[model samples]
Target: MASAIKRSRTSFLTALSLGLLSFGISSCNGAWRQRIGIEKQPVAEPLPEVSDGPRSAPLKPGDNVIVEAVDRVGPAVVRIDTLKRVASPLGNLFGGRAPIQKQAGQGSGFITRSDGLIFTNAHVVEGADQVSVTLPDGRSFSGRVLGGDPLTDVAVVRVVADKLPVAPLGNSNDLKPGEWAIAIGNPLGLNNTVTAGIISAVDRTNAVGEGQRVPYIQTDAAVNPGNSGGPLINASGQVIGINTAIRQAPGAGLSFAIPINLAKRIAQQIISTGQASHPFIGVRLQSLTPQLAKEINATIDLCKVPELNGVLVIEVVENSPAAEAGIKPCDLIRDVNGTEVKDPSQVQLAVDRGRVGEAMPIVVERDGERLTLNVTPEELPRQQ
Candidate 1:
């Protein structure tokens, strides 16, 4: 009986050792596969050398012309910093994570008037419990939220400072594609960082499905996260537009600026009523495509009415100016008040320049016939 028991115990020991050896072999195979064939790490490229010395680009004589623009506008540009306690997710032993508190955010701005009136994007200072502005002269001041226009993403703030530098407004209508555009602002907390680029495009109302009526000028300038509300200036040192948006991602050479003419319009309204008076026409217009133009008038290749004309109306808002003036959806509007509308923007521009209760004549083509409709413009209610 004892001999039999000893034999059984030896057999069990032999099986255990074999099992352990098999496990070790399997583990070694996995490690070898990882090291030899399966795993390949990406090669890291060397970073670009950043010089510690004063990095200055070789300037041409024409570049010196911008010196005055920089010097004159530099003082008005202000730095904006914000702090807010935000909830952060913390590691947890259980499946549920704990909430941790953290402070976050960044931005820029500029003084618009001497009595502390400031200009900036609504998003920059929105929800900021405490707002502060720092001048180039190292003078810090408290900012008051005068009002904000979310449609245009423009906001006004006032700082109680004496003798503030106000930037002179310029006509954005004069800006052309390829014109020099200088942007001066605090980007990424680097105060007074100036970037230069050209006017890539104009009247670019590239709306991202947003229902707002504000049009934006698109540029290829290297505007980044913190450039909102900065000025896009021309060579004459006039602000052509307000820097507002960039591409949804980093690399797309697309940046958008609110037209300075539009900004001036909003700013004037805000300064007067603490809000913007957005102009509206009660008609939805669609560009007259060739096919549609042919459908409306078989003979007229280019629909030109006697009074005012250009875009073909698709719909008139209920009780809107066009509707009240008996304007139909199929009517092709070729002119407004004496200005002939060549495009949708030109129509908008004419309507935008006109005030509520002002009467203007719009020429249209209906069934190969030309007719004039008198429209008494109405104030489009301020969007909430």
Candidate 2:
């Protein structure tokens, strides 16, 4: 009986040793938690209950304006996740692609009207198979793409929720260099990242691209791939621009935004009508300097112009309003509707401000002769 009791004690001690050994090995493996999630054990193995995030500290006097700005508008900003269907490269042995692969992408946006209307970039939700928007308050909803205008890179999204936060819109026209600028977005999958800078410049037309001119607001704020469609805020917490693109080359600090004024104009049209129309005169132009004038004089001949600093017409699309008005290449643009235009952006802006289908009077210098031509504006095509 004593020997049997000793054997029983020895067996119990061995089992306890093996259990400790197994637990130590599993604890050292860091990835174990990912595979083995928390399991509820009834009273036998109790785990500490996790608490929600800490409450925000109360606001005090003399707070930084940037902090105040974020506190006001951060709740309105949302993260937009998208899934796009793409063809898979590793398909059947026949060298064909499979169409079942889904690619994930992310961006950011803000509420504008509070009735579920959100403004984002067209490239964010465009052609997406699925869109999901996550608010800052830990609520999410399936997003609907109401309308998207790729020409202006603006899109409107809708979600069904009550008491949505809205970011107030500001006049981008009133923005000037050196004003405080703030950026908030989900960059590199990190949500609600905030960065601050100043308005580096405004009315930057060439920042978007070579041909597609949008007067972008340039800022030094940090913007990344996932930061697209986020808001660029002013000192008063008003949204001045939509964070769009960043320079890929040297001076990588330069980031660009679509002016909120232009965005609102497009958004209003998309909300009311199914699409937005851009009035264009159908002419490509370059700002003429003395050096550029010299190049034109020595290059292929369409028309000759006196050496001057003004907007130089480069190409006129066939059957367009400019061609119909007899505005030819190498013609130096002097004025649009009697207002002198110093650059190509100003010329485009004047035409946009004027009524479409109405005759716009323009003056150009051709071979030392100033000629006035009347051209009617027309709606730009989607691909334009």
TM-score of 2: 0.77
Lowest-lDDT window of 10 residues in candidate 2?
Answer: 12-21
lDDT of 1 by residue, 1-384 (tens): 000111111111110000000125866677777788785544655422111112223234564757866776778888876565555555563757556444555677777666677778888877666678888889998777777788778887777876787666667886788988889887777888888888888877544332334567777777888888888776666667788888765546587888877776677666667776555657666555555444445444333323333465655566566766777655677777778876665677666666666567777778677787777776666544
Best by lDDT: 2
Look at candidate 2 and tell me the lDDT of residue 324: 73
For candidate 1, give the lDDT.
0.66
Number of colliding residue pairs in each model: 7, 0
Model 1: lDDT of residue 70: 76
Which model scores highest in TM-score?
Answer: 2
How do all models score by TM-score?
0.70, 0.77
* Stretches of candidate 1 exceeding 4 Å from the true structure: 1-63, 82-105, 207-215, 248-252, 292-310
